[model samples]
Target: MKTIAVLGLGKIGSLAAVLLRQAGLQVTGFDQAAKALHDIPVLSDDISSPEVLKCLCADHDAVLSCLPYHLNAMVAAAAHQAGIHYFDLTEDVSTTGFIRELSARGNSLMAPQCGLAPGFVGIVGASLVAGFDECRSLRMRVGALPQNPTGLMGYAFNWSPEGVVNEYLNDCEVIEDGERKLVSAMEWLETLYIDGVKLEAFTTSGGLGTMCETYHGRIANLDYKSMRYPGHVQLMNFFFHELLMRERRDIAGEILTNAKPPVDQDVVYVHVAAEGLVSGALRRSEFVRTYRPIEIGGKPRTAIAWTTSASVVAVIEMVRNGSLPQNGFLKQEDIPLDRFLETDTGRLFN
Candidate 1:
C-alpha cells in the first residue's frame, strides 16, 4: 500500500484522509490547529515551517494539500524537493501557475484545482468537446447550493468563504471567436432551468483552469460560469462593485463568512454543454449531475466536501495505478470522464 500524507485536517481534508485510509492507503494527516478525526492519525505541527513540511513530505509517496490557496506554494515546493507527487484542490490560477512551474523542474506529478468545478467539470467538458468534429461553443457551469435556503443571498457557505470572494473579484478567462481573452467576473449573466428550478450563471475565475489554452483555436466560444439562484448576482454586484468591497477583499471575506450560514444538507450541480458539428450535422452534447450528502467511513459528510475530496483522491488513485502520468503537470481534462467514474473514489460523483 502506498503511503500518503494529507496536509490540513479541515472539513475536506479530514474526509479525504478517511476515504484514503478506507481504500487501504496508509494515511498521515497534519494540521496546525491540532485537529484530529475519528481514525486517522494526525500530526500537530506548524506547516509554515519549511523544515516541518519537508520532513512530512520526504517519506510519503504523495502529499495532498487541503490548505488555503496562499499556502499551496510552500507545500508544493516541499513536495517537489522531496520527489513526491503533489495534489491540491486550489482554484487559484496564480497558485496553479506556480505549481506548473514547479512540475516542469521536478520529477513527480503535480495536479492542482482538483475539485468540483475545474476538476470533474473539465473532464465532462472535454468529453463533450471530443464528440464534436468542429467545436463551435462550450459552456461549463457548476454550483454547491443549499437544499433549503433562508438567507437573503439565497446561498450558504458550503466551502471556503475566501474562495467565494476571490472568484468574484478576479478576472475570468475565456475563448471568444477562437481567441483567448480575459473577461470580468460576474458579467455575461444568463438564466437557465435545471430540474424545474430557475438558476443564474455568470463568468467565474479559475473555474476553467487551463482549458482556454487547451481549446483556444479549436473552439470558437468557450467559457465557465458559476451557477446560483436568481437575484444572487445582483446582491453580489451591489456588495462588491457598488459598496467597494472588492478593494477590501479580506473584510469582504470576513463579512460573508460571519453572515452566511454553513449548510451540511447541500447539493452539488454540474452541467456541461457543447455545440458543434458531429459527422455531417450540427449537434449538441451535455453532461449533467447532481450529488447530495452521503455517509463515508461511517460519518456523514456534506456534498461539497465529499465531491471535492473524491475528485482529488480519484486522480491520486489513477496516478498510483499508472493510469495517469506519474511525473509531470496533470490537467483535469486529460482524465476521461468514463474512466474516472469507474474508479472507487470517482464513483461518488456518479
Candidate 2:
C-alpha cells in the first residue's frame, strides 16, 4: 500500500492521485495522455491492452481505476493477476459482480463502488442502522446539482453521463417488505427536502451497491435513490423512453454532456435515514448534509469531483494504514464512518 498506480487521470482520478500523494503515498498515474501535474508523475500508456495493464499493475502496491465502468472488469482482472489490491469508482452492477468473482481467487483486496452514493452513503447508512436493536428500514439518497440551476431539467452533467444513463435505465435492487427484488429505475418517485431545498428522488441502480445482500434478511425495507431538482425525472424519462435514447447510450451521453457540461460551481446533497426498534421502542436516525465546492490543491473543485475522489482516497488511506482489511472483497458497509471521517483526506467529508 506504499506505492499505488492510479489509472485514468481524469478530473476525479487526477484529483484522487493528488490527494493520495498529499497523504504521503508514492503515486503514479496512468492514462492515454499524461496531463502535467505539479508533483505527482503521470505516465501515458495504452492500458486497453491486457498485457500492458498487467505489467503496469505489477509495479504498484495497489491500482485505483478511474476508467469508465465498461473497462473496470479488464483492469481488475489485470490487477488480480498482478497480485495487488484493486479499487475503482464504478457503479456498473455487472462489473462489480465480475470483481467480486475475482476477489475470491486472489489474495489481494478488490473494492468497487468506492465513491459517493455507493461508497460514503453506504457507510453512513450502516452507521445509523447500528443504533437500532432491530432495524426495519434504511433509505439513502444523493444528488450532484448545479448551485444555480436553469432550464426545465434543472440539472447539470457534472458526472459521467454514461454512468448516469446506465443508472436511469438499469434495474435497481431493493429490499422491500423483507424481499430483495429488482425494480425498474426512475420508478418509486418521492419528494424530499434537504436544508429547505425541495428535491425529488427516485430509484437508481448501483447506488445501493451490495447493501441489499449484506442486510437481506436483517432489514425489511432498504433502498437508495438519486435526488434532483423537481421535474428532473419526468424530462429524463421522456428523453430516454419516448425518445428511445436508452438504446443509444453513447449518443445519449454525448448529447447530454454537450447540452449540460460540467459546472465549476455545484452542490452535493446527501440524505440517509434508518428506522427500527431501539430498546424495544420505535425510533429513527437521520444524517443530512449539503456539501459544496471547496478549495483543494490551490484551486476550486466541483462538489461532485472532490466528494467522489475523497471517499475513495480516504478508503485507500485506511487500507494503507491497516484500518481496513487488506485482502478479499471489501464491502462499503464494512467501513466505519467515524474512522473514515478521521483520515486526512476523509476530513473533507466532515
Candidate 3:
C-alpha cells in the first residue's frame, strides 16, 4: 500500500483523509487541532515543526497539503527535501511560481492548484483544446453555491473565507489578445445566464492557474472567474476595497464567517467552453456540469468536497500509477481530461 501523509486536518483535509483511506492507502493525518480528527484512526502524530514534518513525510510516498497558502512553501520544501511528491490546493500565484522553482531541484512532483477551478477546470479546458486547430478562445467558470439561500447575501459558508477574500483582493491574471496581463480584481464584472439563472462573474485571482502563461501567444482570449448571485460582487467590492476592509481582512473574514450560516445543501457549477476550427470548419465545444450534495460514508458531503477531493485523488492515482510524469513540476493541464473523468475516483466529478 502506498502510504500518504495528509497535512492539515481542516475541512478539506478530513474529507481527503477518509477518501484516501478508502482507496487503500495507509493514511497518516497531521494537524494542530487534536479534536478535529478524533473520529479518524490515523491521527497518530502532530506536524508541529518543519523537521518533524520532513521526517513524517519521508516515510510516505507523497504529502498532500490542505493548509492555507501561507504554509504551502514550507510544506513543499519539506516534501522536496524528503523526496516525496507534493500536492496542494492553493490558488496563490506567487506561491505556485515558487513551487515551480522548487520542482527544478527535486526528484518529486510538486503539483499545486489541485482544487476545483484551477485543478479540474484546467483539465477540462485542456481537453477542449485537444485535437483542435486554429483555436480561438476558451472560457472557464466554476462555483460552489448553497442550494437554498435565506440570508441577505444569498449564500452560505461553503469554503474558506480567506480564500474568497484573496480572490477579491488579488490582481487576477488573464489573457487578452494573446498576451498575458494582470487585471484589477472586481473590475471585469459581467452578468452570465446559466440554466435560466441570472448569475454574475468577474475577475478573480488564481482561477486561471498557469493557463494564461501556457496559452499565451496561442489562444486569443482566455479567462477564469468566480460565479456568484447578482449584486454579490458589488457588495463585496464596497466592503473589501471601498470600505477599506481589505486593510482589516481578519475582522472582515470573521464577520462574514460568523454571519454566513453553514449549509449542508450545496451545488457545484462547472462550465468550460472552447471555440476553434475542426475539420476545416469553425466550431465550438462546451462541457457544462452541475453536482449536488451526495451521501458518502453514510454522511453527506458538500459539492465542494466532492469536487475538490476528487481532484487530488485523481492526481494521486496518476502519480502512483506512473500515468503522470514524475520528478518535476506538474501543471493541472498536463493531465488529460478524458483520462481524469474516466478514472474511478474522477467519476465523482462526473
lDDT of 1: 0.89
Q: What is the lDDT of candidate 2?
A: 0.94
Clashes of each: 0, 0, 0
Candidate 3 residue lDDT tens string, 150-206: 655777778888887888789998888888889988777877777877778888889
Off by over 4 Å in 2: none
Clashing pairs for model 2 are none
Candidate 3, TM-score vs. the true structure? 0.95
* lDDT of model 2 at position 5: 93
Which pairs of residues collide in candidate 3?
Answer: none
* Model 1 CA deviation exceeding 4 Å by range: none
TM-score: the better of candidates 1 and 2: 2
Clashing pairs in 1: none
The 0-to-1 C-alpha lDDT of every candidate, in the order given, reads: 0.89, 0.94, 0.83
* Candidate 1 worst ten-residue window by lDDT: 32-41
